[model samples]
Target: MTTHDPIPARLAALRTTPTPELKQQWRELFDSEPPPFNRRFLESRLAYRIQELVYGGLKPETIRRLERLGEELDGGDRKKSRIRADLKPIVGTRLIREWQGVEQLVTVTQDGFEWQGRPYQSLSAIARAITGTRWNGWVFFGLKNHRRTA
Candidate 1:
């Protein structure tokens, strides 16, 4: 006895659907404007949203557990958690940037970063040292843009 599952079909259809149609579906399903992301992002998120509508979202207890885990990972700092997960590079990864006429190199380390035989806590500090003015390190290093969504 097999039950008809429309989810797979819906998910598959998203891959071939036109961008405008996908945006329409997103507006209908999410009750908001579609994010200005790539076609692949729209398709994947639409697939997830389709499944979530059919099967429901995470349970409250599960959400609480995840929150607890996130708190533990970031020492109760939400901003730090997001930064660590999204922006922090793996240890030993070398970040290179050229300013003016000289090339700058910074190495990701276990504690923080190492640049020019010196240890620094944050990339912003390194960026400031490289340039006289204040700057957002992620933007300066091209890891992120100035106009971030969240």
Candidate 2:
């Protein structure tokens, strides 16, 4: 017997829904003002919320396990957890940028970053080396927007 699955349709509709309508839906679903994030974020969160409402959210044990994993990743520090979740790239990932017609490459490491045969403690330092001026490394490397908070 075939049973209708409405969750897929609900998720698909999020892509076409207008931003204001999505915000309204967010308010109703989340019981709060919609966050000041982009339309994509709204759509994605709405999709997840719709499915979560129908299928039930994660189990308490699963949630606790995820929290423990996050703590492990950030050494049990909430501030560090947020920063790492938002800013830290996977180790060994290569970040490449072009400055003054020269290509610069940086490798993410466990401790920091490696660039130009030298290890650096921060991407801003590498950006300074490449541009000879203070620059937000994430912006210079095109990893994130300047407005994003850690």
Candidate 3:
């Protein structure tokens, strides 16, 4: 049989405790003013802290690795230019457009665009095939527009 412990009772009380009481507990336990988080968040952190005091927190190496990953995610450690949000497309994404009652389709590839089982250097080439006229590939594919023409 499991023994009753004050830790579980405290955790239960923490959940039902008012926000102002939890903030006071937070200050007493953490020795600092509690953040302006909601009551549930406050209770969760306090519960984790209670367990951490009995057990332990994560290792230093694990903490460092997590911090490094967070930095990489925040773009703090990137060497190369970030991919443009507008140009980013996973391979196999389909681009479809209808012109002259015909549905034109193109598949995005790692290297470029593909149409009709043949790879094209640019969307403009596919657009030219569809319309037989020179056109900006991005504009023709509805990806962008001729906003800044020389």
Winner by TM-score: 1
Off by over 4 Å in 3: 1-4, 77-150
> Tens digits of per-residue lDDT for model 1 on 59-131?
9999999999887766886567667454589889999999999999999986689999999999999999999
In lDDT terms, how accurate is model 3?
A: 0.83
Native-to-model Cα distance after best TM-score fit, residue 3 in candidate 2, in Å: 8.1
Question: Per-residue alpha-carbon lDDT of model 3 for 1-150, expressed as tens digits?
Answer: 997768888888887888888899889889999998777889999999987787788999999998787666546635323544347466889999998998988999866789999998789999998899998888887888679654
Predictions in order: lDDT? 0.90, 0.89, 0.83
Q: For model 1, how big is the CA root-mean-square deviation?
A: 4.7
The pairs that clash in candidate 1 are none
- Measured against the true structure, the TM-scores of the candidates, in listed sequence, are 0.67, 0.66, 0.46
Model 1 residue 58 lDDT score: 89
Q: In terms of TM-score, which candidate is stronger, 2 or 3?
A: 2
TM-score for candidate 1, residues paired by index: 0.67
> Which parts of model 1 have CA positions greater than 4 angstroms off?
81-84, 96-105, 109-112, 116-124, 127-150
RMSD of each: 4.7, 4.8, 10.5
Q: Candidate 2 on 26-55: residue-level lDDT in tens? A: 999999999998999899889888989999
Sort the predicted structures by TM-score, highest score first.
1, 2, 3
Worst 10 residues of 1 by lDDT: 78-87
Count of clashing residue pairs in every prediction: 0, 0, 0
lDDT of 2 at 122: 93
